[model samples]
Target: MFSRRTVLTGMAAGLFAPYFHDVYAQSSALPARLVLVLECNGVYPRALLSTGTRAALGGRANTSDRLFWDAYKDTPLVREGDNLASAISLGPLAESAGKIDLVNRSAVLLGLSNLIAGGGHSSGTGGLSCAVNGAGATVDAVIAPRLRRGAPFDVLRLGTSSARVSIVYETCALGPRKPAGIIVNPSLAFDSTFGSLLGGSTNGRDRKMLFDFALADSRKALAEFKGNSNERLKLERYVSSLESLRTREDQLTGMADRVRPYLPVAPKDNPLLTGAGSPPDSLKWFEAQFQIATAALLGGLTNTVVLATGTSGFDVAYGPDVSDVARHNLQHGLDAGQNWEKVAEVTRRHVQLVANLARTLAATPEVGASGSMLDHTAIIFMSDNGEQHHSTSREWPKLVVGGNALGLKTDGRTVVYPKYDAPRNRQVSNLFNTLGHAFGDADFNTFGQEGSTRIAPGPLSELYG
Candidate 1:
């Protein structure tokens, strides 16, 4: 009666029974919502720090703009450990602007590896597994099956930009050679997900009849309750709830107009609605996608969402003065200045969007709890590529925010593993495994294929409080 999974899980438990006896447990029935922002074209981890930390750590920062340096910059690291959570900076406006402390609650992971993905090549599931081209399910899909139980959608994989090259655009894999489909059209995504409530499901009369019938049925049931007085009171409350449902439905009928503005703008003079339907690689399109994702999460349509944008060689603009340039070219040793500025700019923008989402969730109270929903949610910001353009798969930096509800240690502590040459260096698969363990899935001792890199089984013990 034992399947391969059961056997593997049992074997793993026996191996780690001594060290992880109490570390492993069942996944919480109320797990945190997952939002994955998959960045392409690598990241400049050194540029994110200050000159003092960068000098000690030997990083890159070739900027002459004092105003820029004064603004969107922070060391976040020291000789010993990271600065306390409050000292962390959010963006260029952090010094002058006052906002929420969402950024301070973030964690940065250094000294991580994939050992499988080649430079300038998207790993697909290879990032999570040794199987190339997503021979197995990636980390997001692995968590989706359990986190999104009974949700309207299994996992909402969305992105900006269509394929301009024959790279691994699809990150989620169903199995070997099977990449999950991603919806690149923003307007279509909105229509497919919320169209029913937007008057695209049934005609007005049919909808009215359904609501009317439900109300009448509930009222009749309330009148004929022949049980105890307490039972009669419950029936009356049920009848009242039916009437409330009708009011909510009527409110939804008129909400489409208000919702349209937040969606992608339609093409000019194009009846096919080509522009709006397609999620182009523009800032507006990305924001619109964020709006749709926020709505889906808030509406309880999906529990896990993955959003990806651009690629390594892709061209993008950071500032008004800075023209569009290819990220691959800028990600070099001598060209570190341009790369530092652009990466910082892009990261600030994306993190601002994350801040917006966190703010929205923070204001909204949890469904059946006392604190806000943000207390039970987590967001991961990581690059599909590693720490440099045309990376050697040596380092994959990551940022995780707001996983306290899932038992994660997110006290703004920046954890940097030893260098690859050092003894006991770790890879990202262990981080993914650590995540799986946090989510109560100890069966996945290690994700991906058995590549040449040496990796130990089990999660990073320091990541938990």
Candidate 2:
């Protein structure tokens, strides 16, 4: 009877042989990286439509207008032009306040539907996983290991909620019945990722000591147990998990010198994060999480990250202008009685933050490559729900930036597929499949849950170079 530890060891050494080899023998050139930014309450579809696109669709203002949906029902609309910057929601990404020009490297995707995800206010993990009620591994988790380059973390999940929750598991997942955790507290996230660089905090030391004690105890049990019973198998699995965790910790601790140069200025604690009933500082948390993710990417700590905000079950009060308004109310189109300007501002803030990330990455040189870090990375901003609050999962829009090195044809393009009811309509799973292909997973065409909603197999060929 083989022990669980032995099985895991063999799998790591043999099943993932090529990945392990790449980790130790990677070349100076940087591998492709991915960043996914997901937000709740859906994106206002009209906000993404530029003047030219609006004109092409017969100058429709209301996206819900039957005429608007019919305009692109039979034929898809694909345009790459100078008018992308004119879109209200895309202005910040096109030309940030900091003057970074990402428009040429960006693409706006529209008309993709995902009914299998069961969208309403939010799709829970379904938005990324493309499984009903988040019943499978998300795209981030699926691709992280394949793209891994010996980073301490293959994928880092970070998020901020309207509530004072420290962590959440509603977004990404590892596999079926396995949900991943997103660090909601910035301080805790920093302590976990960069704490070792600052000589290790008391909490870190205590955790390490506990791990050591558990490992010692487990080894003693392994020595004493003579039979390969179910109990012993469980013990072996537990020990293997502990050992893997310890190895990861040791790797992070050994990289102090390498991580120090890229460390972010640690976030100062805010009083608003104290009480359970106190409103969360949404803006502050967003900024801190973005900074930490960027630092982690630059320091070679993680290659894939999911930065989420107001996902399902998270009704965070937004930043300054809309701080007083209930996020849920805004989602219902009730910000100061039927005006959506506040909602637009909230969406714009998320875009501006993404723009800042793109800008910083564009200015920084790749660690072991010729061009800037932004050139080798793919950044995606998407709505967790579909096109509107209480969505019917009819249309989903995405804003994609960078990834020139990964064969993505994102050169100021605007792609509007046929309507959801159209026979040729595609789903969000196709996008994930496309990304899987871009990451060099050539045969990763069937990515998510399949049913009648699936238009066809394979990646969106139009997205690739």
Candidate 3:
């Protein structure tokens, strides 16, 4: 007969023994991954649509009429016009258009209003995660625990800007108002967040020493809190968070070991990229982060990630000849011919980011899986507002990519909702709830009040296989 202490020790070892090996072949099915790419301000809807009168003059004025002018009624927005064939198009994403059935793989929910009654960037942030009324969890937070289970690095919030207001959430409804721990200084040590298990580059023996130290410290901390009632609860949560971090560190170390041999060593003069003056470098770093995030997901290190492209009123100079206008101002110039061209350029840049992520996922072979990592992950790309000036959420430019292997049809079909008055439109919460349902939360209906009251029923069924 086994003693209780021996039995418990055996159970613990059984749970963690898999960490000793790559464990990629342990499961045949890859875990579901969710990534949300959020662009500050809003997307220029006109850049997404090619219908209605393209005349430079004032053709029609009704906001409702503007909604129907887009190609959602007859064809996917990508096929609407010739100018958009190359400009403001999904670019390389065109490859994914027919391979996955749009009608079966994805759904576009247009005309959904952001019920939040405030104005400007903060409100957009609030509306993007929590509903307009500030009464629901961000979709990323809601689905994180469910999808990854005990995996480390459940949700990573990353941003390019130093402004805390842009990257962190103020609303409590979005999930406990925990500080996001934003990585503003690119030079900041990754060790601070992922050091213990992976170790730092000081000494040859430091790796094993650090891991042993972390384990001892964790055990001591647990033992100290065993007697204190209130302290025990706090320690429990701390242990939980730390354990998750430990798993992440282990997986990251394993992946780094595997990929480091194939990667070029960092150049001595590789200054950390920062600031608006370095758009090209900024774009490169952004792409690098996306690659890192994809690698983490493929390695089972994390299941959810939120990436912010630019913050509200983000003012980055393109060049001396180009307009140095901010994102919001540039978006407001949608009706102007030159402004539309600029908008198309910006939209193209955004699409390029998506393309980079998609390509990375497509390239990574899933462990113990037949398809690529891209086939198992669902990516939602959206902006806070549909257009620059309108502020209304009607005819919002949103896209859902990947997740085909997890029962999503991604052929790029556009689904337009019946026109409604601005107030009665589907709330952005609908998208949040729909995402939750996709991750296997069957009870995930009615996010915000406006979402429950106004949005169409349940998840958008058109995208599911």
Candidate 4:
């Protein structure tokens, strides 16, 4: 039949086909891991560049219109041998002497654009899928199954919202029209991940019942559907979402024994666990999700994970720091009182959280590897949209930590591709292709919409060569 599932599968195989032999032909060494951390709206490029790097690019030091225009130029991270100069967003990663101790193990990427994603308000599924809006399988979906050695789950998708939503499905997808869910409620996420070990929690059991019923209903409805193509597409997406949840639940049950030993303790003093009858802000949820993700990675539950905050129409009002302006207003580059620092504060907080996760991984040793877990893992931090709140899909800034085991040349390096207007400029799809190459797919060059004449083909040789 001409169903969406078959079409999507075929398209994926054609667009970003994975070679089974190459993906599986790896030595006995432990597989490299991936953790993608994404924030919502947009990230100002200036917030991420160090003073010296900006100066080197002749960028004005202030946040005025002149400085905003200067951000489009090629600006690299200021480096001294093996150390990077401090940027406000990365200041938390620095030591007491104000030196970034993690510079030698990190890399900063700039000037890559994603016009194909159609950025505004948010990129939705396009952020990870690299396809417009909600089309195509996201990078996580394409890479997770290939990289998952023996993990119970294919990918761990956790998220935090400004609101008290239980789940949001804006940033990930399995295939065309198949959106992946981000568990926004920490309490529910904990129950989903670890609850089965203790015979399952009440919430988990109740939620499972609802999920099963919905899945059954969707399948029945799909079978009965003799509607138009648009209606059929909607039904297919709904069924796909339910099926994805069921698959995760089944995996959790089957892998309970394997996942039990590495279970992380439930978040302590978490507001979500306080029975407050309301969800806490993104700050509290971000910390909880991080704790859960660390456990999932270290425990061998999953080698690929995605942690999100303030994405997909979720809450962006972090605290009094941002003046509770939410995402739309904050994207204006001003709070209610014209406080630009508030915007920088939110961006810095995201970077701070990412840095802490990197430090934690660096501190722990890989169970079957010679170096620390960080050496074998890649932690990527980026904004869902491009630069600024109302993003123009130009000059996306990215930061990556570790992944030395995965052939990443991120040792205190700052790679700034040409601006989007330049003929030789690179796209985000190239970066994704580079990651696919790092994860053992040697010939995996065509990712996302790179087949288009507008985009260049192949992985970024500057990153992995």
Candidate 5:
């Protein structure tokens, strides 16, 4: 008889493996994979929208989720027609952002609103799930379960080691009122997934074998079911899942080996005890989270990931590069007498991290598949509130990267839905449903705030390929 811990050890190692690996099989036909990146205190709409957007819209003022221009392919993600990739402020990845944007599979969702969010810090689950206190599962949770047979962990919530963020930063809600737990520290997260075992074992190889054997038992169980012809049909998915798990274990093992050098080493003492200083290790813990996220996606450990980049709990004085003040202050434009450029710098830093994530996935060669890992991923980065430090729920423009996967059409276009006052105005719900469509869920036709007369129920067909 296997102990509960032992069973769990096997389940964790293999549950998601089947679903993630099969759905994420390297193909343009695609399966379901989503990475949702949410930030607080909205970014400016002007900065997010390109100069070409107006002309593409034909200078039309009122339209909602309406198709404006169809590139059918990606172009430079720079503002206006100019291809100044270097000026995009992706930090170390600035060089690739310009060139990649041209061929990158992506899109932009403009004019999204969360009237239900009630503005302010309520942006928490409000912005993510489009319902207060996560009254509905966020898009990530809703779609994650659709991947193949569902990943071991349906949704993996991750938060940066930065200081505390407002309620606006709640990254994921598994179901109605079910906010997902976040693993704040990357080192702890790594151990939880790959370190700690049931028998207080710390050796990575031993743990891997133990889990692998447990998975072998699961496969045997499926085989027992298969022996009876009557049960074979019902157990087909079971057999596929177990087989996928066995195959995915190798992927996970390879990923672990590849990411070992980039892992963050923990400290002997809690550095929060200090009165003044950085985290005491300048190895970039934020970067570590992205590295883990990449491996998780690449290895099929999870199909959905929600990352809240910087919180107020970890105070980072970015120094002369951004500011000597806390991120919260910079977010609110309170530090240094509200230096807007400083705020932009902080926002850019977040973008840079996101850019790095895209680049990392792009670099990884997908096993038994074509293109890179990114070709089979869809990453959405958006703000909890509208375009301002404080929001009015008017305009929420999100940057999208990764395409060809998830059945996302308009992969290379900027779509501005009708404004708030327009007759055919679309709400944030439509965009969320659009994601649902990408996940291949016929049931997720419409999600969020159903009873209201103003609510529109449907996916953005214009964006759904």
Candidate 6:
């Protein structure tokens, strides 16, 4: 019988050998670790910021509502509780946020507005992915190629539902368009992607054999072009694509060597939903996807990823008490007293997901890098709109964490952009462009429609060191 290692080696060499040439020659100096966390219905600005006077809470000054007037003061020790006595008063999300290196390193993009023209929530969601005025490319697409020049999984666009899946569009050479690489139920994809990583199971061993066979074929094909530059490039990429796979295998090996062996529980027997149906066990599915994404990032499997927890038009039931209110419905009453409570709860759940992801990254140490895996990673967390009713983008909660290890800043207090005058609104594209530049896109100055009055030139200078 062929040894397991031999089989896996043979499969990777064979299957991945063909595509290595082109990918290796064209690579960029972007972050090898990146993640994008997007939420639906936006966040309530009032809750995220303090306004009234109550006395400075925590370590930082300006913890009262009066701090809202400054827009530049930072909350030192905002925590979650009934009384807003902490530095970064995050309300329900206090627990998770506290676990990470909490900093008001975020900045408000005042005067920024979404170019939502048609199609209610669905259309707006599409616009968020691409196009601030008309159909255009999104920030995720712009940075994906730069980060994963030699990797197989350049960008993993994942979502909880069908609508969420379409949030990241790809602008290819053909034209400005959307790419078809969405993993709607990423947990199932995770199982299939790293099947061999869960060794010991009969099914896993069989999958490993198949992968080995493919790798052997790829290796054979690569040998045919030994000295050719193009072929050598292809070989290099094939190796890079296997990074995540190799990491999984190493993890399994270590697990096997442990005194007490442990294995992931097999999935339940219920059929998960595909498109338009119930919520489809989002909590469980998302947690699994998070694990897979974290593994991929830690193993250098892929450099860029966009994970949409849910879509903008989602109306699934979160729980019995939460009601089956559509995301759009929650935003319409954001200004109302009672509506803020419901919105706060939904937003808190979303925040919890992000916090969980951050903590996971922080826990894992990098191979050749100092600090935890999260230290070298930059996570961009934001929503399509600030509220559901209007497309206004002012006071939008845009948080950037962990890039500080990558030379970005987030330790100081929150900084608000200069207010715009009159009816002219800043376009969300400006914010998008700023993100692109942050990831090392030198010529990435402008995005979206020309003269659309949506995208401004403000670079969000305060966000950087």
What tens digits encode model 6's per-residue C-alpha lDDT throughout 1-465? 222232222111100111111222234453446677665445444444433212333222243221132332232222222222132324422335346433432222222445442323433333344343225545555566666744545565565543444233221111144333445455455454445454446766675566577667767777676577986996866755554454444444344332112223433432233322455545444545555565455445566666665553354345435435654555565555555576566655655666666666666665455666566677776655443435344434555556655555545334333333224334455555655656666556665554545534644454543
Write one digit per residue (lDDT tens) for candidate 1, span 120-196.
54555565454555567667666766666444455667655445432224566655665655555455565544443
- Residue 287, candidate 2: how far off, in angstroms? 1.4
Candidate 4 C-alpha lDDT tens digits along 286-360: 766776776666556677888888766644555554456665666564644655677777767777777776776
Q: Model 2 segments beyond 4 Å from truth?
A: 1-30, 59-67, 96-98, 199-207, 222-233, 261-265, 269-277, 335-338
> Which residue pairs in candidate 4 have backbone atoms (N, alpha carbon, C) closer than 3 angstroms, thus clashing?
162-315, 163-315
Q: In candidate 3, residue 279 scores what lDDT?
A: 46
The window of 10 residues in a row where model 1 has the poorest summed lDDT is 12-21
The window of 10 residues in a row where model 6 has the poorest summed lDDT is 12-21
Relative to the true structure, how large is the alpha-carbon lDDT of every model? Answer: 0.55, 0.71, 0.49, 0.68, 0.54, 0.47
Q: Is candidate 2 or candidate 5 better by lDDT?
A: 2
Q: For candidate 2, write residues 60-162 as lDDT tens digits.
A: 5435332256667466678876467677777786654557788888888888888888878878878888888768888887887776777767677887876
> Highest TM-score among the candidates is held by which one?
2
Worst 10 residues of 5 by lDDT: 10-19
> TM-scores across all candidates?
0.68, 0.87, 0.70, 0.78, 0.67, 0.64
Ranking by lDDT: 2, 4, 1, 5, 3, 6
- Residue 349 Cα positional deviation in candidate 4, in Å, after optimal superposition: 1.7
Candidate 3 structure lDDT: 0.49
Q: Write the per-residue lDDT of candidate 5 for residues 214-333, one digit (tens) a residue.
A: 667766776676366767764666666555555544555555544343333332232321222454221244445565676566556676777765432433455444566655566665
